[model samples]
Target: MKRIRFVLITLSMLLLAGCGLQNTPEFQPTLQDQISLYCLDHEGNLEMREESGRLQGYCVFTDGSECAEADFFNGVCKAGEIFGEASKRGEIGVLSADEAVEVEVNSGSVDADSGSDEIVLE
Candidate 1:
């Protein structure tokens, strides 16, 4: 009887130990961690969110436009566009001048009697 009780107790303890091991904490990265990793791997600033253990967000431009939607799972960006219209705009200049030119324009006078609001550019 003593040996049977000892064996049963030992088996129960072993089963409990196995259960504890199964419940060990998993190394799941948070939204910020995923974003940091994404930024390091990719270019530009990206905003991220975590949903059902997956990270999702959009790469935003300086003008506050949605460049692309990024979806990351297990710390990997599975789908998204890195650069969009904003990046293209950055590459292309709006105005190009061969040489610097000086021009003067009226900045509006504070006093009606005095015309001293003229701004001179050099």
Candidate 2:
């Protein structure tokens, strides 16, 4: 009886050991993960949530400013530089002078006081 119990215990231990030997693949970080990591390293706050069966990430700076990273819109902060509005395919692109000028011109056209507080009835 003692020998039979020893054999059973040894087999159980071997089975448990074999369970840990799974051929699981290593985790690979996605683009959103990479962006979130970059933001985290740049003194920014990270927020992650699931929406519509998809994961989304957002990064907010210390000065109450948030950056956007999405399709056709890429915003990342690296080495004290802000990169904005471009395609993000695992690469960061610098904004050019002409694009900056265009953005400035477009932004200048919007005036906070342009809208009248009182509506005029005809």
Candidate 3:
């Protein structure tokens, strides 16, 4: 009887621990709901834009050839080849609404250079 009780108690503890883990907030990468800001390259060129209430952001070369496209939300860029290249070249910036001033992309906070092809916004 004592052994059964011990096993049951152990199982209960494990279940509780699992429940706790499930309740704990996980690191989920979610896009911003609104376009509060847009990201640009170093040359002050627009890297991301919203079209028809959709997020449409991409990277283009001087020759006008699109290299990569990434979703931009709340100043965050996710998944694009050209975006990663631009990021590596230190040519990424974020601009807030009603402000022409460009802000540097935070390397620690931004997931812009992620090579994943997953389109988060649209």
Candidate 4:
């Protein structure tokens, strides 16, 4: 029964994913297409100034329900566990929102300079 529910929800999220996946902040060797790594306890924040000029806001991850909203100068990234089925069912409390965020620890940059041939998004 549990497996069936997981499969159904997985299918739903897949169908809803259109193309906004390149902005995930999980800090992996290689980024996943539509899946961002969700952290359980370790939380973080970042003030990113993208060269593309399309991300400026806050990225927060706390207890559950992480979100990322970038603007023109700096952007934010976060990840956390979610309780209910619908992702939009909760509020952004601890990870509410911030503009002056900064990246203290990042795993994504470790992947940026590595050889493209040895890179794989697992």
lDDT of 1 at 84: 33
**Model 2, 19-111: lDDT tens per residue?**
999898899998867766777776777766675598666566666545453421244332333444332333446543235433222222334
- Of 3 and 4, the candidate ahead on TM-score is 3
Query: What Cα-based lDDT does every candidate model obtain?
Result: 0.50, 0.56, 0.45, 0.39
User: Which rank order by lDDT, best down to worst?
Assistant: 2, 1, 3, 4
Greater lDDT among 1 and 4 belongs to 1
lDDT of 1 by residue, 30-84 (tens): 8767755664465446776675597666555444333333332232222232333
TM-score of each: 0.31, 0.37, 0.25, 0.17
For all candidates, what are the clash counts?
Answer: 0, 0, 0, 11
- 1-122 per-residue lDDT for model 4 (tens digits): 99999999998888778554566687545332112222212343443445346643333444434444321012223454222212232333233333343535433323557754233323
> Which residue pairs in candidate 3 have backbone atoms (N, alpha carbon, C) closer than 3 angstroms, thus clashing?
none
> Distance from true position, residue 97, model 1, in Å?
13
Task: Kindly report which residue stretches of model 1 are placed more than 4 angstroms away from their true locations once superposed.
Answer: 23-58, 64-122
Best-matching candidate per TM-score: 2
TM-score of 2: 0.37
Tens-digit lDDT track of model 3 for 16-107: 99887656686664443122223243222345667659866554434443422333332244322233344533466532233454346444
